[model samples]
Target: MKLFFSYLKSHCKTLFFAGTSVVIFCGIFALDNLPLSAVGYAALLSVCVGLVLIAADFLHFRKTHFQLLRLAKKVRYGLDGLPPAQNRIEADYQTVLQELYRGMTELVTDCDCSQRETEDYYTLWAHQIKTPISAMHILLQSDENENRSDLQDCLFQIEEYVEMVLSYVRLNSDNTDLVVKQYPLDSIIRQAIHKYAPLFIRRKIALHYQPVSFTVLTDEKWLLFVIEQILSNALKYTRSGGSVEIRLESGNTLIIADTGIGIAPEDLPRIGQKGFTGYNGRQDKKSTGLGLYLCRRILSKLSHTLRIESEVGKGTTVKIGLESTRLRVE
Candidate 1:
């Protein structure tokens, strides 16, 4: 059988050496019984046979080594770091190594698929949770008295965090839920303004957008989420009577500038990390640290980029660069 020959190839060298040594020893022991010429001829024959066996053993090893290498190449595809081989032309070692390789590949693939399923579940959960959140908001709106104002504020905070969680979950999905197409940039800004109309009106914050007509390719819902997060952060930190302006600058970059307390230099570097509120959020414990983190994640999927510029006590401006312009045919 092929397997038997494969096994034999590895142990051939040892077997050949042992057999030759035994034959040589027997020849030496029986030397007096035979004629001197016959004894001499027998010794030469034994040496010649040993030499042939050694050469054959090496040739067989070379053939099997090539086969094992071909198998290794197939097994190593698509893996990052692989371990070094410990044995060459080894039957049991080869068998064990192959099994280990197959197991690792399966493990990585399964983990990726499981992660995706988990995200999908969270996305479904977010939608379901929104229904109850909407009902609560409606009930709060019916009683707009000063006593209910505090409760309303707390409810609003809960709604904001839930929306952020949903955005974060869908950020890294394989299929971008973006509905990208040509749309008036002004119209998109209007929608973003409408969604956060409550915050702007409540804090007496001014929402100023430059009047401009431009078309861009993007998913409307996700793009709005990115804008809302930036605007929300601006309004939260900006003192009452401060201004938050949305401007469409050159190079397809949309800037959201807030005249609120700005980020510290040390905190700026880690602003987009998940669940990281830094010094400002620490001061205001109401911060979930998920706003900017969700913004970064969603922007990345839309093929856009987000950049930040700020100075302490001066304020912060978050820029979202729409990159679909690069894909446009001139």
Candidate 2:
């Protein structure tokens, strides 16, 4: 009804002109002394013709409206679903749309190709560098000299950087090699602790770790990486004779607390962000700022949560919440 009214409004002037023309013709017939009944019949016939023309126009307009609506729906779903245009205007619009889609697709393809190439190059470079790093570690281990400890430390740092590069690459890969399974939480903790045992000895930092009786379903490799990162950070900032404690609290929260130069309050919020080196990192130029970022990301992927509490001149406590019930056992 609304559409009909709108159509009538648009054709009102044309209708008025047609009616006036009919009235003028009747007046001419009347001036020529035509019969009144004949003139009235002629006027009615003219009005009937005009009504038929208007109805035909309305039908055409209604059909076009519905067709355009359907086309809009198809375009909304997908560009490829756009139907063939019936008019020159729609054809021009479709041409522009197709060109835009093609250009966007090409841009995306180029980006993907470039990203794959970069990942491949770095992955290869990281592997190639590891050969020498391994050789150095082996050579340093054979040496019984007092400086061997320093050499080993340097080798460890190199290994850490290499691993960081590999991890960074893998994190952005299309296919993740994540193998999730049930593993003893204590075993994972011990592995991380053992990796840094030499560091603890060298720094004379006291380690206080107790075995937890719970098992967690997670990707052991990724979880170990997270644990190692947390442990490394704790050990890096702690002073000699200071202690690092590892404990499992209720609700499956694993706490790693260290008597280290703690994170500043303002800097704490941004520590998990990539490339965010806070006060301690600025003070210690060797800090890469990727450790916490990687840890947070990996933990999140494993459906775990990482929370940090710290105060300057006091200590830092890192809590990792592990909920085995959240896991899909299969």
Candidate 3:
């Protein structure tokens, strides 16, 4: 009924013109002294014709209206499901849709190409740089008489930066090599500590680690990277003779507390953000600002949480909430 009324409203001007013409014709007939019954019959016949024409137009309009509604729904939900156009106006709309789809497809293709190129370049560059790094490692190892501890440290830093590059590239890749399984939490912690043991010895920082028997479901390689990054940061800021403690608390939380210069309060919140270096980093001038950011991201991927508490001039405590029961295979 609403559609019928709308159709009538749209054709009101034409209806008015038709009615006026019929009245004029009847007036002419009346002026010629036509019989009243004859004139009335002609007027009724004209109105009947007009009504039939209006009904036909309403039916056609209703069909078009329903088609438009269906087309709109298909365009919004599934463009591929849109039916073929049956009218000129619908054909024009379909042409515009095709153009838009083509443009979008081209844009997506270009973006994918650009991303692949970038990944290839970085991957190749990382591999090329490793050759010299490996050669330098061998040389540093062979030259024991030269007291090459500083060279060894620099080499380690270089390797870390290279690994960071590879990790950053892979982090955005479509296919990530993640192997998740149940592993001994203590074993992972030990591996991380062993990797940084040389740094601890060189800096004379005391280590306090307590073994905890717990199994956690995670990608061990990724978790080790996170732990190493955290440990590296703790060691970097900590003074010589200071201590770093690793212990497991209730609720399966792993706490790594360091007797280092704590982070500033205002900078604490933004530390996890990529490329964010606060007061401590600015003072040290050696921070890459990616360590904690990477740690946070990796732990989040492993369904764990990292919470930090710090006070300037005191120390920093990093809490890793490992809710093993909530783990899932991804």
Candidate 4:
């Protein structure tokens, strides 16, 4: 009954005009000498009613034109800001708008999920490739040292680049393939330091590690990557006589400090952005700018926080906080 009243209100003016015209035509026939035919009068009245109804329907449908345009704009902007609809066709302009908004939202969500999976697959593939690469490197080691020395180094560099790519991809994984369990944090740090033993020795940088044994729940592989990146940066900036300190502070944090050329004040804020090396990196030209960025990303995924303190030409210290139920009891 409410719907019927709404329709009548929309066409009331047009209906009144049609009725007035019909009454004038009927009066003209009644007053003139022409015969008043009932069938002709009924046909003329039906035509007036059809025309008014068509006009009313057009006005009702056009009311939603602006709303439909707004929904289309939402789809173009790539935001999943609306819900889905069932029937797109045979619907009013507003209903079509709802359907479009819903479809666009679903499309964006699927794309986001697919993109993450692609990154994970790429990282996994890179890691898998390293196994064969290691085997090949081992075979080359059996040859005469002088003959294979240059080739061996080249292969090693390739392996490092592959690992770097994998680390970059894994850094942003929302569903990170991390197996967190209770493990001695110090053991992992020792293992990471040992991996870069040759580089530290060749650079002639003094290494200092304090025996602070603390256990935490964390992914070992990801933590190792963070450590490696920090060590690389320290070694890159430190002079031959400088010392790199790896120690624990307050039992919940791991600190790595180096007496190296530190970060510039202006560029410090941007250090962890992807591919952003800033003043120090551009000046040195050796930094990929990926190291610290990847470290920050991985640490964030693992629910850890990293902090940096530096003074130009003096040194820098990177501290990582690992807090979990698995932390050792005092």
Per TM-score, the best of the predicted structures is: 2
Give one digit per residue, the lDDT tens place, for model 2 in 1-330. Answer: 998998888788987888788878978998999899998887788778877988898997777677667767765344755555769998999899888878887888899999899999999999999898888888877889889888888889788888888888888888657888889999999999889999999989999997889889899989999999899889889999999999998859999999998999999899899999998989998887998999888888889999999999889999999975565664
Ranking by TM-score: 2, 3, 1, 4
What tens-digit string does per-residue lDDT give for candidate 4 at 1-330? 555567667778977987797778778777785665764777577888787777677565454444455656765764343333325643365466667768878988899899888996897899799888989888887877675755764675577678788766765556556787777888899988897786677668999998777987788888988898888789878999899999999989999999999998998888889889888888877667887888887787677889999999899999999876433322
List, residue by residue over 1-330, the lDDT tens digit for candidate 3.
898889889888998898799879988998999899998998898879878887887888888788768777756443675556768998899889888978887888899999989988998999999999999988888898566998888888888889888887777777557788888999999998988999999989999998889988898888888888888889888999999999998958889999999999999889889989999878878776887888887788778899999999888999998865555666
lDDT at 54 for candidate 3? Answer: 78
Question: lDDT (CA) for every model shown?
Answer: 0.78, 0.87, 0.86, 0.78
Predicted candidate 1 versus true structure: per-residue lDDT over 1-330, tens digit per residue = 564476567677877887788677667768657676776686788769967886676666666566556756765583222333446745466567668878997998899899888987888888898899889888888976776766866787777777777766766666655677777878878887887787788778887877767777877788887887788889889998889888888859898999999999999889899889989999998777888888787777677899999999889988889887433332
Runs off by more than 4 Å, candidate 2: 1-78, 324-330
Task: Tell me the RMSD of model 2 versus the true structure.
Answer: 5.6
Clashes of 2: 0
Q: For model 1, what is the error of residue 210's alpha carbon versus the real structure, in angstroms, after optimal superposition? A: 2.6
On TM-score, the stronger of 2 and 3 is 2
After superposition, which runs of candidate 4 have C-alpha atoms over 4 Å from their true positions?
A: 1-94, 109-117, 143-157, 325-330
In model 1, which runs have C-alpha deviations exceeding 4 angstroms? 1-90, 109-117, 325-330
